[model samples]
Target chain A: MSQPGPDAPSQPLRITVLTDGDTRPPGLERIEAEADVVLAHDEASLRKALPGSQVLLVTDFRTAALEAAWDAADSLAWIHAASAGVDQLMFDALVESDIPVTNAQGIFDRNIAEYVLGMILAFAKDTKQNVRYQQDRRWVHRDTETIEHKQALVVGAGSIGRRIGTLCRAVGMDVVGVARREKPGDETFSAIHAQSDLDTLLPAADYVIIAAPLTDDTQGLFDAGRFKAMSPHARLINIGRGPIVVTDDLVAALDAGEIAGAALDVFETEPLPADHALWGYDNVLISAHMAGDFVGWRDALIEQFAANLARWQRGETLFNPVSKRFGYAPSSQ
Target chain B: MSQPGPDAPSQPLRITVLTDGDTRPPGLERIEAEADVVLAHDEASLRKALPGSQVLLVTDFRTAALEAAWDAADSLAWIHAASAGVDQLMFDALVESDIPVTNAQGIFDRNIAEYVLGMILAFAKDTKQNVRYQQDRRWVHRDTETIEHKQALVVGAGSIGRRIGTLCRAVGMDVVGVARREKPGDETFSAIHAQSDLDTLLPAADYVIIAAPLTDDTQGLFDAGRFKAMSPHARLINIGRGPIVVTDDLVAALDAGEIAGAALDVFETEPLPADHALWGYDNVLISAHMAGDFVGWRDALIEQFAANLARWQRGETLFNPVSKRFGYAPSSQ
Candidate 1:
């Protein structure tokens, strides 16, 4: 285990990055200036690189190769996930290990919030129908619903959820937040309820946004029963982990017209197979797990990782340290 | 001429409503209880009904029947337009007449603002692409732009433009307003500029929103030259009048990719003739002129007109009185 006190390391730290080779963080040369850097793509490369590496940077958060190579990581002291959700990287070996895990948290909050707001507005304004009418060269004048004074129940009380609530409030929405723990109401949320209240809150929501992490408690949280509880006119937007929503149950709910529509950025199986029935639903909007990704995000992630690297070099506590037990970085607030 | 003083009329006023036979204000029975109500859908009916009517309510503001039958309007004292823009009704005979024209201005302001925000968010988050990908059943991950900290220039300092600016500001955008006359800065706009500044402001805007009235000064304002002045990445949104943008020039600019895209609600022609080339553009989002028409808008319009009618009956000053010379209701502010 690495010591916690402020003592400079005697030698250069070994940093191994796991990515699909399409995008490694830009400005990585800044980190390479001090450390010995290695890029690995698959299980074989990761296994070969994991031994004797002091720090592992999971740029490709989707890969579970790290878990398979955990026994080979003899000198790994820390892991940094270049993503807000670190569920894929949270294997039993990692949770049981003494290594500290950090995630890119604050970086994606406002971007994801904007994405959620966009989806809400898209549903309210019926933009999908507008596109359809345009495609057919048919000019149909239709009345649209206003989102103002409408109820939005955000299913997470983390930074991203709070930011989503704040943006929604700016547009005159009545925002309610549901979290694992009860929290006092703030400018963003009119009220914050415990997870136990989700069943009660779901029916009242015109928009339900999921920004919660995928923990054991949250896995399959939004199943058939919860979908059945939501208003028929309500929309579901999930930017969180995909498994949190039972895909088969969601399809059934959507098929039954239990809800108006949904915008799913993440999926249970990403690169969501081409033959998936979810794609066939006109009411269901599908995007490739990129709600939080903005142009230049790679540069920003590199900057964040460099800052954390500097802290690690100084033996100081890292920012956005994730709680292995909770499966997310606990909110600093 | 109707006298302007605080004295109730001895006789009930005769009201004629011009509509397209599709929608009439809901709960209009309340108004019918006090006045002699006549509904007319065409020039023949309008001309026959106009002679003895004390008030003419233009529910279908797109009609020019009022102007054509103006000589037959012997007892028409007040004209109420159930629309913000009175351009169509601002014919020579009506504008030169002493009859006071009142419009449903406040009713559309916030709703149109919401529509503009929805468009801005749609452009930023690329919701259009999301739909296309969903249709194709392809899950391709890509980075999206953020609306926060982006610059939006709204061309019109009226209530609608101010409302749009306020909503944009609430979502962390920097808003600039342009109008015919200069005004002091407000919470919504950082600064208000003269229409002359539009040339200078166009380049700096990431989003250019047209909310100005259709007048001699504004008609064809966004020609090919003006489109060229905008950034390649900037998007144009017109919720105002379609003639304000030269349709052919807009098509040329769009084809040339001079601007990123556009969301055009009101077009130069109604129902935008099916074979028009504008409908073929993937980048353009076309919606029928229904931005301000929310679910209960007709009811709201009736309520506004009813209040104005009560004032007219009491011989009191009316709300939303248009400036004949300017072609829109003069803002009381």
Candidate 2:
């Protein structure tokens, strides 16, 4: 509702790009040609460049520079994130501000869904064991479980979660989705339940996938009680935000055999310290949080931002507008 | 055509079982009640037991004792293999005889298809690299390939291959099937080609899956030339017989970077010796011949044979009859 009306500003638009200086987003020349653009690589630079800027284009999702420079933003109208999850950008001031926020959401759904399915199949076929045995030059013939007719419970019935459910069902899995609000089942999900029903749903799931956004209600969602509710034969896959799961409790669950295993792409502490206990487990699959990053993904993210920027210049409603109260775009499902 | 007429035999059926003495097939009490059963553990036992038996049920797929005891099968009316591939039972004398052979075909189609899909997804996602990184406790972020709209070429458009095609298509891949005879494409495949079209189809496929049976025509089907024809980005998956691809040529292909990688479940040599070079490649995934061997698969195989036995008792046509001339069942595709 805070989106600007259809009246173009008389002055030239000013945009500030906060980057980490690793790689600059490509295909931004056209945007730079018409606007006064400033690339801020650090908090001091961001603070220096924030004054007189109407748009903040955040390329570094890991930096807290924007919040540190918030007092300098005297004329900011909007904030645009280059990533799907806008958790890093949702500081207290921004959440309480009148500035509207948008994100790169639809670009990542398919690739992330594919990544989740790959992890599910990897566990079912025991690919990691195959690698370990091959390394030892051992030919151990083991019987693996079949994914067919197995149950998959995906938490988060948003675009990414629905795509995960669709792919799981494609491979003959009985898929059920858990959303914040209940909806009628479609081709992808056999049923959709409210978040409160997760406890009852966990016991029958062969694979429990977390694709929910990071929100106040979802933080620490997969704690001790949730893990204990899961079937011991189930695997936990978190492609969602890291803090949604308590790391120590997950370690304990793995130690006690409360769950079969976990394929974690995100963590509370990233580049997870060398001596982290999760690294020592044979069943854990640790990825470097690159689930949605396919080849040429940087360009795709930039393209999405550029399109949304065009809409902003003309004072039109934006795509993927985040609901500040909920910390994510509420589902139309 | 060799099946007996629908007239109940006055004498009780004499059945011989060829086993390697490891484990006996379960759930045969009902069959044993109506038949004179003899369990043969070796070549000498098989020869001694074959003189009066009208049916031979083979449980040991790797044994050559059947060929050694062929001369003693004077009263042989039918042969049933407890495995999908009847390659070991297809000796010259058996192939040249009027006696019919049947296999456990339909029992393995879905599981094998699932295995093939898992391998395809593994290579696309770089799961082996994740395992290696986890072993070193390193966090290496890398972009992976998306399987959506990728092309998959399936060699051998029989029940197993068709199932693989169907599953690949379910995940949004463009699938093509290869068979002995060309047929119009169905819901599973975008097109169907004859065996001769493999050369043209090889270059375009992102994944080439071998699901053909081991036979005179298919033996050494993938040699140096076939490997050269495949795209450098393509990964080869073999869930079919081992000799379908030449191991030495595969090694050379890897050395020359002819193909991206291979996920081999079968090899020309069983237990793929510890000294074999295939075990050393980071890109190659070596799995013991267990692609279709899900939990309870042994019982499933026996169950298929039992159903066939019931039909044999009623003098009706058998399921999965081998062509003998082609060394496999002529596919209905």
Interface RMSD, in order shown: 0.8, 0.8
Which is the leading candidate under DockQ?
1
Q: What is the lDDT of residue A324 in candidate 1?
A: 96
DockQ of prediction 2: 0.84
Question: Candidate 1: lDDT over CA atoms?
Answer: 0.88
> What's the DockQ of model 1?
0.88
Best by TM-score: 1
Off by over 4 Å in 1: A1-8, B1-12
User: Which residue pairs in model 1 clash with each other?
Assistant: none
What clash pairs does model 2 have? none
Alpha-carbon local distance difference test for all models: 0.88, 0.88
Backbone clash total, candidate 2: 0
lDDT (10s digit) by residue, model 1, range A261-297: 9999998999899999999987888889989999889
lDDT of 2 by residue, B81-158 (tens): 888788898899888889989988777888888888888888878989998889889999999899999999999988
